[model samples]
Target: MNKDLADIFGNLVNRIVSFAHLAFDGRIPEGGAPGETELRLAHDLEQRIKALHRHHTALEFRAGAATTRAIWDAANAYQQHTAPWTAIKSDPARAAVITRVGLNLVALCATLGWSIVPNLSERVLGAFGCNNAVPRWPTGPLLPLLNSGAGTPVARLGLPVEKISSEKVAHLTARFGA
Candidate 1:
C-alpha cells in the first residue's frame, strides 16, 4: 500500500506541476496568459498539493482520510475557479489534466474508504470530455508496514510505509455500497 500510495501521490504531483507550468508560465500557446485571479488560484492549488506531497513523502507515503480530503478540496477548488474560463475549458490538454486529476482523486478516495459527494464526482468526470476512463488502483506486493500497523512518526501527518514483497500481487478493489 505504501508503494501504491507513493505512485498515486507522485502521479498527482506530476499532473499538478504540469498544469501549473501551463497556468503560470503561459505555455498554453494559443490560450494566452491567464489573468491574475486564475494565476493566483492555480498557484495556491499547486502549492497545497506540493505541501501534501512533501508531508506524505516524509510519512513514507501513508496518509489518512484528512490528507485525501485536503487533496480533493484543493483540486476541486481549482476546478471550480477555472470553470468559468472558456479558454481553459475548451483546451483539451489543460482540461484533460484537471479531469485526470479529479478521476484519480476519486479512485484514491474510494480505495481509502474516503467519502466524496456523488454529484461533484459526476460533474468532474464530465469536464472537458466524457471519456469513460476508469481509475487504475494500485496492484503490487503488500508492504509489511501497512500490515503490521507500525509506522514512523512524521509530524503527525501520516504513518510510514515501505515496500515488501509477498507471494503474488495483491489487488485491492473498492466496492460501492448500494
Candidate 2:
C-alpha cells in the first residue's frame, strides 16, 4: 500500500529468504547424526516461517479494510442501475478506489518475494506425518516449482545431496523400516 508498509513487507521477505537458505542448504548448526541436521533445520525453519506467515496475515487484514472502504465508496454512487452490483461498475470515484486497492495487493505480493516456498513445503511434509522433517528436494511436482523462475531464491540456496550407501539404506530400513 503505502511506502512504509511496502518497506516492512520487503524486509520480512528478505529475512525469510535468508533463513530458508540456512535451512535448505544444511548450513544450520546440527548437533549430530545423519537425519539430525535435517530435523533441526526443519524446526528452525518452521518457527521463522510461522512468524512471516503471521506478518502476512496482518497485511491481509489491512488490505481487506482498504478494499471494504473502496466498495462502500463505490456503493454511494449507484443510481440508474440496480443496488449493490451497480456500485462496483458505475462510479468513477469508486473505480479509482478499487484500482488503488488492487495496486496495494500487487505491491504486497511483490514485496513478500521468496517466503512462500519453504512455508508451503512445511505444510506438505506435515500432511505426510513428517512432523517438520525436511524432506528431500525435487521429490515431486515441487521440483518444477523449485526450478522455475519463481524458485530463483530456492535454487540459489543449493541443497546438499548426500549419497546414501546401500548398507546404510538397509540398516535404516531395518531400524526405522520406512
Candidate 3:
C-alpha cells in the first residue's frame, strides 16, 4: 500500500512538473492560433491538471488518516501492555507512525506544486517557525515560464522558441543574420 501510494504521488508530481514546464516555456502546441484543436488541447490539459489535483488531495488525506489510525492503535496496545501504569511506550510503533507521516508529507509537498521554491516558501515557511521573507507566486499562467529563456525545464528540454509569424521570422533573420 505504501509503495502504491508513493508511486501515484510520484507520477502526479511528474505530470505537474511537465505541465508547469510546458506552460512556462510556451511550448504549447500551436493550432492556427485560436483554432479548435488548440482550444481542445487547452481544455484537456485543464481537466487533467484538475484531476491530478484531486487525486493528490485524496492521497494526502488518506495517508494522514492512516497515520492517525496507526498512532491510535499503537497507543491502545501500549496501554494494554502497561495495564496498571497506564502508559506503555511503544517506540517502534511510534517510529512507524512518524515514518508514514513523513512520507505522506513529502508526497503532498511534491504533488501540489509546492516543491517549487516560490510556492513552497510562501506556503510552508510559517509552519516551520520561519518568518524571514515570503516569495510571491507567479502572476500569470504557467505558459510564460515555458516560453521564457529563464525557465529551467525549457532549458533542460532544449525546446526552441516557436516561430508564429513571417514578420517575426524575418525580424529574427535580419537581427541575427540567419
Candidate 4:
C-alpha cells in the first residue's frame, strides 16, 4: 500500500474512534434536556463525523466481499441506532446503547486494516467530557496537499484516502501503476 494512503487512513481511523467516543459520552439522562452548549457540541461532532465518512467514501477503497459486507452491516447498525435521536432522547440509556453501536462500527473499521497502526485503539482513548480531554488531530498540510495535484495517493484520489484492501490495491496498481 502507498505510505501516504496508509497514513491518511490511520489518521482518519484515529479521528473516527475519538469522535465515536465523544458521541457516546455526550448522551444526556432520560427526561433531561440538553443545554445550548451541549447541543452545539453535539452538532459540531455530528458534522465532523459526517465529514469523516464522506471523505472515507470519496477515497473509493474496496475490500473483500465479506469484509465489505461486515463494514456495511456495522455502518447500517450504527445508522439504525442513531437515526431516531430525538425520539430516543427520552430514553437516555438507549441513547448510550446507540452511541455504543457507533463505537462498535468505528472499532470494526479500525480493526479491519483501515488503520495502519496495530495498537491504535490502545493509544487512542475515548475520554470525552473530561477536563483533560483534547483531540490530537493531525496538524499538518493535509488539506492543501489533498487539494493539490501533488501526485500523492491522496491527490490522485482527488480526496482523502481511506482503507484499501489487497484486491483494491491490486486493481489500482494495475490501473495506475502506483
- Residue range with the least summed lDDT across 10 consecutive positions in model 3: 151-160
TM-scores of all predicted structures: 0.30, 0.20, 0.23, 0.31
Error of 1 at 171 (Å): 21
Q: Write the per-residue lDDT of candidate 3 for residues 1-178, one digit (tens) a residue.
A: 2333333333333332343343334222221122242234334434444554455467765544344333323323322332311111344333222222222222233233332233433333332233445422233332332122221221121211122478986997899997
In angstroms, the error of model 2 at 51 is 21
Q: Report each candidate's C-alpha RMSD, comma-separated, in the order given.
A: 17.4, 22.9, 25.2, 16.5
Per-residue C-alpha lDDT of model 1 across residues 19-76, encoded as one tens digit per residue: 5345534121222333454445445544554555555567734343346656555545
Candidate 4 ranges beyond 4 A from true positions: 1-66, 81-84, 115-178
Kindly report which residue stretches of model 3 are placed more than 4 angstroms away from their true locations once superposed.
1-34, 60-153, 156-178
RMSD of 2: 22.9
Instruction: Give the clashing pairs for model 1.
Output: none
Stretches off by above 4 angstroms in model 2 are 26-178
lDDT of 3: 0.33
TM-score of 2: 0.20
- Highest-scoring model, TM-score: 4
Ten-residue stretch with the least lDDT total in model 1: 148-157
